[model samples]
Target: MVSIFLRSLVYNVLFYVLLVLWMLMAIPTFLLPRRVFMRVAKAWARSSIWLMSAICNIKVEYRGVEKIPNGPLIVASKHQSMWETFALLQFFDAPLFIYKRELGWIPFFGWYLMKSRMIGVDRDGGMRSLMEMARRAPKEIRGGRQLIIFPEGTRTPVDATPNYMTGVGQIYASAGVPCIPVALNSGLFWPRRTFMRYPGTLVVEFLDPLPPGLARKDFIVRIKASIEDATKRLVDAARAEQAQLFGRVPAKT
Candidate 1:
């Protein structure tokens, strides 16, 4: 336990240091095209993944990447940990994220988010905010950008009850694009609300895409079922692996 705690401490410190360095290096991208800045961002994501593996012994496997379609699409992924936010960027050409408006108020980090043209919504704005998101999503989709959103809208602990929001379905119906459901067991290794990073395989599987034009109700049901079922399988598998590594499954907080 002490060894794990020390490793987690080192990993956390290095992760932030690396982030600051990358941010400084990417400053010039602010003047370049959006794609150019996106390349920088992807590189950073890759670096972070590699660092976690090197220092924390966490191996990452991305399955069914070939299943991801080209052109405008919606990537609805399970929200487990903060890992997916940037790790998933490497797979898309033009990836867009819907984030809290307050995050856009941060210093350099927020500035880059604005430069990338990510959608920011006021959580306090109620239905009006959702309507605005629904209206703006299709335009971006038409521009050939992949909108990556978490159906649950926030990260949930491993084995927690699924609480998918209806807003993703609204955006999907309006965007008129196939939605790829992604399932990952990231919370097992990178549990939220804590600094500990565990050693184990972190798997992200891209399930089959739900075709465009389904009724909003049906779309929501299908996406939720697909993501939750696949996520359960992943979490179970990772728990077994953790047990083998540590003589017991670590309790997820």
Candidate 2:
């Protein structure tokens, strides 16, 4: 426990230090083309991942790069930990996220989101807000940016009951693009709302793509099943490995 706390403290301190510096350095990116700004954003993510590995003793390994299509698509990923927010950015070309409208109000971070031209959804604005999201999403798709959305709407702990939402289906129906379901066991290592980072490999698997033109109902069912089932397997596998090594499953810290 002492070792974990010390490592977490070092990782947390360095992570924020790098984050503040990166944000200040990236202010110039706002004046450049969006693509160039995104390249800088990916660099920041890479640096953060490196810090996590070097200091926190955590590493991320993902597969299924070939499964990602060349054209515009929807990357409907499992929301586990916050790690995927930036880690997944490096894999897609011009990826746009569907975030809460209020998040765009943050200082430099929000400015970064605006410059990236991400899709913002007004979750509390009722059906009208959703309709607006549906309407605006197609423009991003037409621009050839991959849309990364969490089907669960929020991060879920490992092995928790899934709360897959229909909003993702709405996006898919409106965007008219294939949905690539990505499953990961990141919560096992990084967790949500926690400072203790575990020493382990985080596995992110990109499942087969759900092709466009399916009925909304069918698309929702397929994506939920694909992501949930794969995510459960990852969570279970990680737990088993942890039990084997530690003589008991390690709880998220």
Q: lDDT for each of the candidates? A: 0.93, 0.86
lDDT of 2 by residue, 124-158 (tens): 99989888888888778867989888888898887
lDDT winner:
1
Question: For each candidate, what TM-score against the reference?
Answer: 0.99, 0.95
Instruction: Pick out the ten consecutive residues of candidate 2 with the lowest summed lDDT.
Output: 244-253
Which segments of model 1 are wrong by more than 4 Å?
A: none
So what's the TM-score on candidate 1? 0.99
The per-residue C-alpha lDDT of model 2 at residue 177 equals 81
Candidate 1 lDDT over residue span 1-253, tens digit each:
8888998999999999999999999999988999999999999999999999998999999999999999999999998899999999999999999999999999999999999999999999998998998898888987999999999989999988899998898898888989999999999999999999999999999999989999999999999999999999998899999999999999974
lDDT of 1: 0.93
Q: Best TM-score goes to which candidate?
A: 1
